[model samples]
Target: MSLTEDAIEKIIGKFGRYQTWILVLICVGRIPTEMQLSNVVFIIPSVNYVCLDEGAFNATNYCPCKYPEYDTSTIVSSVTSTWNLICDRNQLASLAQSMLQVGILAGSLFYGHVSDRYGRKIAVLLSLLSEVVFVAISAVVPEFWIFMVCRFLIGTAVGGTMLCCYVMIIEISGKSFRPYLPGLIELPYSISYASLAVIAYFLRDWRHLQLATSLPWLFVLFYYWLIPESPRWLITTGKRQQAIDLLTYIAKKNNRPTENIESLVIKIEEQSLKENEQRYGTYLDLFKTSKIRVYTLIMALVWMCCSHTFFGINQYIGRLQGNLYLNVILSALILIPGLILVVIGSLYLKRKLSVIISFSVAAISLLVFIIIPSNMENATLAFAFIGQLGAYTSFVQVYLYCSEIFPTMVRNSAMGFASVFARFGGFIAPFVVNIGIEWASITIFSALAFCAALLCLMLPETKDTVLLNTVAQTEKNKVVVNQEST
Candidate 1:
């Protein structure tokens, strides 16, 4: 074990009731974010639409409306029916979905910096509060543009909540619990996502569904009282007393002795002071070295592909030939096993190999669907679900892999940059789906997954490896490893 790990053991012990309570709180914070993300599945259902000018499309026997007014009686009410966003205006549905990703891109960077400069608790509370307001406003928006803007804002807030809370939980948890933490946290997302189908099925109206998802977030505001500021971050920022108090509370809650707490505090304070002497690296440092630069580029592409294909499949849920509710729920459930596999892989196998194989499996599953005969609908559906499983698993692996690749100082910045690219992919996904040819979009998605798999080949395995603290340390360790191998 490293010094920090050993120190943490003396302070908090391994995973305990205190750590479990913190994890539960963190997981609760993510529930609304997932609900908002999947709520679009219900809000944008296809309706019976007709062109505004019926005369514009005149055939000898029949005429099709170019801008069809929706036949609302036969279908559930949605953004399409409420705003006449069908036919010529149908692109707005995709725009609304994509808008959230754009907000996430900007929000992650902004909130990540805020968490670093201010504190995790502040960032998380503010984010949750903002998410509630934006989502509530979105539910009652008078215009499509306003709705899109609100979604963007909500996306931004969700980004802050996700990053701040997630990082804080990881920072505060014991080392023995680290490997299992991410996958376990992801369970809340899957559960929330699956619940969207049930809620949407009952709500039916877009506004009602929005209200249902948005209102629940209001309760999350109470987290300010329930969760505390991260002790690690406090120590790093030179808030020694605050860090000591928080750690002491954790130790007490875990039923550990507090008599030795002073010594542990002194050690942490000394280490923090010593580390503060070193220069912090910027995001640009990720590219200063050839090895890290290549890794960064490859990982960025991987992030982009994952976000692109993931959202691509999600937004196209309406196109699937079945009950929309069933499709969405089943799709979410399909990812549960994938999430479990990710935990297993991260715990047992090489990280790089796990990522590559998952990507490969996903790519093949997706590509094979194109060749499946149209008559074999069940077979095609089965393959698509299999593809979703692999894709989501790969997505989780990439997130874990990226966390390990970048060192502490600029890790969040590097992640923020990669997320921007992922949002770029999401920004393009809505348009990609509307390419008028479903197969062509599938071809592009499959190609990107294949490329991601190849890129994963070039990354070093990070499982069971010590996390480097700085760019200088990483570079020095690389040299030492090279010299020893030679």
Candidate 2:
């Protein structure tokens, strides 16, 4: 165990009041992030429309009218209807959604460096602040282009907030709690996702729904005072005093003695300095060695697959043959089983096996959905839910698995690197959905899932392993595993 982990174990005894507070704060903060990410489902829902020129309409022939009449029985108003994003302009809706992913892609790359160079606290705070500002702007922007810009900005913040917050949670947690805590972190996501459906149901107007989602983030902004920088990050950055102070505070919070905190922090600093001297910890270091390179490549692929299917299914919810509101709720709620699977996997299953199982389930479920007759709407929906469950499970598992596999020095960067591809997958999801062929989209998702599962077999299982602090340690683990296999 690293000195920081040892000190935390001795001082806080693992899951304690201090860690509990951190978990709750970070997890609660994620609610708004999920809200903003998933709100697109309601913000740009599908609508039936006809040309405003009644004389041009007939049973067999239709005219392309610049002015369109929208049936707003379900959605009072949306970006689609407000701008008449239909017919030739229908691609604009997908573009708006894709813009958010583009922003997130940029943010992931930007914040990965920021989180590592600055501190997790600052990255998270800045991201949250940006999310609040941009989302509110998105709610009120009269011009579609202005709204798209806001969405892109919001996506950037979302990417930063998610990456940094997740790293902070893992850094502060103990070994026993580390794996399971990530699963718990996903609980708020499910809550926010389901709640958004209800919120959108009441507030049919996209702007009102956007405001409802954006407003709750104001409360999360208060986390500035509640959350602290990761002690491990402090130690690695050569901030011994800050690490000592933080560990002392944690010790006091957990009702443990602070007497040895300083000594522990000093020891951790020395070890970190030695490790730092051995190698320059940068994003490039991830691919410096063969084993690490293989791990990085496989992780990137799995993340992309997970995001592709997960977001594709989410974006396609409106097109499903059912009540849109109910479909959204059911889709969000189906994630509960996936979350449960994550918890169970963290405790009993190996990380590699868990990921493989989840991906396989997703692929098989999607294939079943494809085979189901088109007229059997309920059966198809059931299969879709199953597919989503598998995708959601794999998605959350990858987060935990990725964190465990990477060293602390480059953990955030590794996540950021993989997230770049994930965002790319998400960025294309709307375009895939817009293809207007449901079976074709499902085929793509299933193929990706199958490939991801197969690739996962190449990764080393990280369950119950200590989180490494340096690339050298990771390579050492690889050597031991190879020796054992031989």
The per-model lDDT (C-alpha) reads 0.74, 0.82
Error of 2 at 443 (Å): 0.7
lDDT of 2 by residue, 205-317 (tens): 98887777777668776887899998878887778788888888887888888887887777766765665564225678878987778788889988898899988988876
TM-score of candidate 2 relative to the true fold: 0.95
Q: Encode model 1's per-residue lDDT on 1-486: one tens digit a residue.
A: 243244655688767788889788777767778887777667765565445565655332223345455555524788877786665677787788789898988888888677766777888888878887888888898988888899899889877776677767666765556567668878887898888788877777788877877776677778878888877666656677887888899999999887877677667656545544443445677788777687778888988998887777777765777777788888888888878788888777777888888888878988898899878978888888887777778877787778767655556666767777888887898889889887898888888888888888877666654444455545545644344224
Worst 10 residues of 1 by lDDT: 58-67
